[model samples]
Target: MFQKIFRSYINSFSDLRREVWLLAFITFINRAGTMVIPFLSLYLTKSRGFSLEEVGWILTFFGLGSVAGSWVGGKLVDSIGHYKTMTASLLLSAVLFVLLQFPVSFWSICAGIFLVMLVADAFRPAVFVAISAYSKPENRTRSVTLIRLAINLGFSAGPAVGGLIIANSGYSGLFWVDGITCFLAGLLLLKLLHPKKAKENVKEVNLNPQAVLNDKPYLLFIGAMILFGFIFIQYFSTMPLYYSEVHLLPESDIGLLLGINGFLIFLLEMPLIKYMETKNSSALQNVILGTFLVAISFLVLNLTGWIGALLVGMLFMTIGEMIAFPFSNTFALKRAERGKQGSYMALYSIAFSISHIFGHNSGMQLIGEFGFNLTWYIMVFLGVVACALILWLIRILKKEAVSYSSTPIL
Candidate 1:
C-alpha cells in the first residue's frame, strides 16, 4: 500500500515538459538560498537592537521596493522577454544582498532592505511569464504547483541550515550564502535557457490582449488576493517573533518549526493539487476554502498556549497556502491576454507587495501595542473580508460568462 501510494504521488509530477522541470529546479536553487528573510526580524531585534516599531518601518520599506520591482519587472518582461529580465534581476539582487550585510543604522538598514527586495522581487513577475511560456494550458496550475513544490523544498532546507549558520557564523553568513545562490541560479538559467531559443519555441494563443486596467473583475480578484496576502504574510513577519517571545523557543527550534511548514507543503501539495484538478473545482472556491483555513489557523493559537497548538496552527496554515497560491497564480495567468501577460502578472505580484506593505508593519505594531491575541483576531476578520471579495469576483465572472474553473476562460 505504501509503495502504491508513493508511486501515485510520483505520477502526479509526471507529464510536465522538460522546461517546466528545469524552471522548478532553478526556482529551488534560488529559494534554497533564501535564508535571510526568515531570520531578518530576529536579526534586527536581537543583534541590531531595533525596536519592534523600527522593524515594522523597515519591512514597510521592503514592501515599497517590492511594489516598484513588480511593476518594473512586468514591463521589462513585456518589452525584453522573461529570460533577460529574470537573468538581470537575479544577478543584481545578488549584489544587493551582499551589500545589505554592511548596513547597521536604522535608516541605512531600511534603505538596504528596500533596495534588496526591489531587485529580488522583480524575479516574481518574470518567472510567472516564463512559466506561462513553458507549460501547456491544461497543466498550467500543476506546473505552478511543481514550482511551488521546489520553493517549499528549498525553504524546508533553508531555515534549518540558516539556523545552524547563524549559530556558527552569525547573520553575515546568511547574506553570503544568499548572494552566492542568486548568482549561481542566474548563471544556470543563462547557460541552460538561451533567450533566442526560448523566444522561438514560445507558443502564443489568440488571447484578447486587453489592457489590465480595463479588466474590472480581475482587479477585484487582485483586491481579494491583497487581503489574503495580508492575512498569510503574518506568518512570515510576526509569527516568528510570537514563537520567540511567547513560546520562548530558541532560534534553532524556531527554524525547525518554520521548516515544518515547507516540509508539509513539499510532501502534500502536489498530490493535493493533482486531486483538486480532477475534481474540476473553481479557482475561487478553492481560494475561499484556503482563506478560511488560514483564518482558523490563527484562531487555533488562541485556543491554548501549548506548544502543540503551534504545530496544529502550522498544519492549517500550510494546507491553506498549498491550496490558495497555485490557483491564484493560475487565475492571474489565465486572465491575461497573450501580449499583456506581463502586465497581468505584475499586478498580481503587486497585490502581494501591497499586502506586505500593510501586513508586516501593521502586524508588528498590533502585537507591540495590543498583543498577539488581538492581532490574530484581526487577521481572522480580514480573512473573512477576503473571502467575501472573492465571492463578489466570482459572481462578476459568472455574469460575464467567464469560466474560472480548472479550465482556462479562453
Candidate 2:
C-alpha cells in the first residue's frame, strides 16, 4: 500500500514539459539562497539594536521597492519577453544583494533594502509569465504548484542552513550566499533557456485580450488577493519575532520551526493540488477556503501559549497556503489573454508587493503597541474580509458565464 501510494504521488508530478522542470530547478537554486528576508527583523533587533517600529519602517521600504520592481518587471516582460527580463533581474539583483551587506546606518540599510528588493522582486512577474509560457494550459496549475514545491523545498533548506550560517559566520554570510546563488541561477537560465529556443516553444494567440484595468471581476479578484497577501505575509515578518519573544525560542529552533511550513508544503502540496484539480473545483472556492483556514491558523495561536499551539498554527497556515496560491495563480493566468499575460501577472505580483508595503509594518507596530494576541485577531478579521471579496468575485464571474472548470477562459 505504501509503495502504491508513493507511486501515485510520483505520477502526479509526471507529464510536465522539460522546460517546466528546468524552470522549477532554477527557481529552487535561487530561492534556496534566500536566507536574508526571513531573518531581517531579527537581525535588526538583536544585532543592530533597532526598535520594532524602526524595523517596521525599514520593511515598509522593502515593500515599496517590491511594488515598483513588480510593475517594472511586468512591463519589461511584455516588451522584451520573459527570458531577457528574468535574466537581467536575476543578475542585477545578485549584485544588489552583495552591496546591501555593507549598509550599517538605519536610513542606509532602509535604502539598501529598498534597492535590493526593487531589483529582486522584478523576478516574480517574469517567472510567472515564464511558467505560463512553458506549461500546457491543462496542467498549468500543477506546473505552478510544482514551482511552488521547489520554492518551498528551497525554503525548507534555506532557513535551517541560514541559522547555522548565522551561528558560525553571522548575518553577513547570508548576503554573500544569497548573492552567489542568484548569480548562479542567472547563469543557468542563460545557458539553458536561450531566447531563440524559448520562442520556438511558445505559441502565442491573442484572444481579444482585455485590458486588466477594465476587467472588473479580475480587479475584484486582485483586491481579494491583496487582503489575503496582507494577512499571509505576517509569517515572514512579525511571526518570527513572535516565536522568539513569546516562545523564547533560540534562532536555531526558530529556523527549524519556520522550516516546518516549507517542509509540510513541499511534502504535501503537489498531491493535494492534483487531487483538487480532479474535483474540478473553482479556483475562487479553493481560495475562499484557504483564506478562512489562514484566519483560523492565526486564531489557533491564541488558544494557548504551549509550543503545540505554534505547531498547530503552522500546520493550518501551511495547508491554507498550499490550497490558495497555485489556484489563484492559475486563475490569474487563465483570465489573461495570451499576449497580455505579462501585464496580468504583473498586477497579481503587485498585489502581494503592495501587501508587503503595509503588512509587515502594521504587524510590527501592532505587536509593539498592543501585543501579539491583538495582532493575530486583526489578521483573522482581515482574512474574513478577504473571503467576502472572493465570494463577491465568484458571483461576478458566474454572471459573466465564466466556467469554473480547468478549461482556459479564452
Candidate 3:
C-alpha cells in the first residue's frame, strides 16, 4: 500500500524538465508576495475609507487594465521574447506597488490600481508561454499544474501571514512587503531562467501579428471562458468581503479558510490530474465539470450560514479551480501554433480579466439590494450557461481537429 502511494506520487511528479522546475520556483516566489489581492477589499474598506460600490468600480478599472495588459503582453512577449517581458513587467509592478502606497485621493487610488494591474497581470501570458516553451507536449498540463502547486504553496503562506501583518504593521506593510517580493521574484528570474537555452527546446516563435484572431473556434472558447470566469473572479474580488462583512469573520479567520483552499490544491490536485490524464479526460470535460462544481460551491453558501459550510464550499471551489485552470491553459496550448503561444495565452487570460469588469459590481449590487441568496442563485444560473457553452465549444474543437487531420498535403 505504501509503495503504491509512493509510486503514484512519483509518477505524478516525474518527467518535468529542469527549466520547468526553475519557472515553477519563480512562480512560487511571485505568488508568495500575493498579499495585496486577498486583503485588498479590507484594505480599501477599512484603511482607505472606500465604500463597497466605489471599491467595485475601482477594481473594475483594474480589470480593464488587466484586459489591455494581457493582450499587449502577448504581443510584447512574441516581439521581445518572454524572459525580458516577464522581468520588466515584474519590476515595473514593484515600482507601481510603492507608488500605490502614496495615494490619498480616490482617483489616484483608482489610477494606481489600474496601472499596477496593467503591469503585473502582463506577467501571466509570459509565464504561460514559458511553461509551454519549457515542457514536453505530453507533460504540458502537469507542468502547468506544478506551477500552480508552487503558487498555492505560496498562497498558503501569504494571506495567513498577511492577517498578522495587518495586525502588526497596517496596510502600508502589505504594500511594501508585496513590492519587495516582486523585486525579489524579478531578480531571481533574471539570475536563473536562461531564455535562449529554453527556446531551443520549443520551435521558433511565430511572429505573425494576426495569427491568433483568425481562429473562430478559439474565439468561441474564449467567450465561454468569460462566462465562467465571472464567477471565478469572485474568489479574489468579493468572497473575502462576504466572509468579513456578512459572516463577520475576522481577517485571520478568512485567511485560514483561504489557506484551506491552498492546502487542498497542494495536496490533491496533481494526483487527481495524473489520474484524469491517464483516463484521457478531455479539456472540455474538465471545464464543464469544474463549472458544475463551482456552481454547487456558490449554492452551498446559500444553503447554510455555518462556518463549516463555508469551508466545505471552498473545498469544492478549490477542486474546481485546480481542474479548470490547468486544463483551460493546456487547452489553449493545444489549439495554438508555435510562436503564437503567447497570443493564445493572452486571449485565454482575457476571459478572467473581462469578467472582472462586471463581476464585482454585480455581486456587490445584488447582495446590497436583493441579498446573498439571490446573488448566489444568479451565479448558479451563469455557471449552467457556461457549461452549455463549453459543450458547444467541445464540438467546435473536435470538428477542427478532424478537419486539420483530414487535410492532405498536395
Model 1 per-residue lDDT at 391: 87
lDDT of 1 by residue, 1-410 (tens): 99999999999988888888888988998998888987988999998999988987887887898998999899998888899999999899889888888988999998899888888888999999888888877788899999888887887778879999999999999999999999999998998876554554466554557788888888998998998999999998799999999999999998788878877888889999889888757777898889989999999999898899999999999999999999889888877753488888999999988997888778988999999999999999999999999888887777888554446332
Per-prediction TM-score to the true structure, in the order listed: 0.88, 0.88, 0.87
lDDT ranking, high to low = 1, 2, 3
lDDT of each: 0.87, 0.86, 0.82
lDDT digits (tens) for residues 1-410 of candidate 2: 99999998899998888888999999998888888877888989998899988987898888889888888888898888899999998899789888887888999999999888888888999999888788887888899999998887887778879999999999889889889999999999998876665564476567676778888888898998999999999998799999999999999988788878877887789899889878756777888888899999999999887899888998899899999999899888877663377888999999988887877778888999999999999999999999998888777777778664445321
lDDT score at residue 128, model 3, on the 0-100 scale? 88
Largest lDDT belongs to which candidate?
Answer: 1
Q: In lDDT terms, how accurate is model 1?
A: 0.87
Better of 1 and 2 by lDDT: 1
Following a full C-alpha superposition, what root-mean-square deviation does model 3 have from the true structure? 3.8
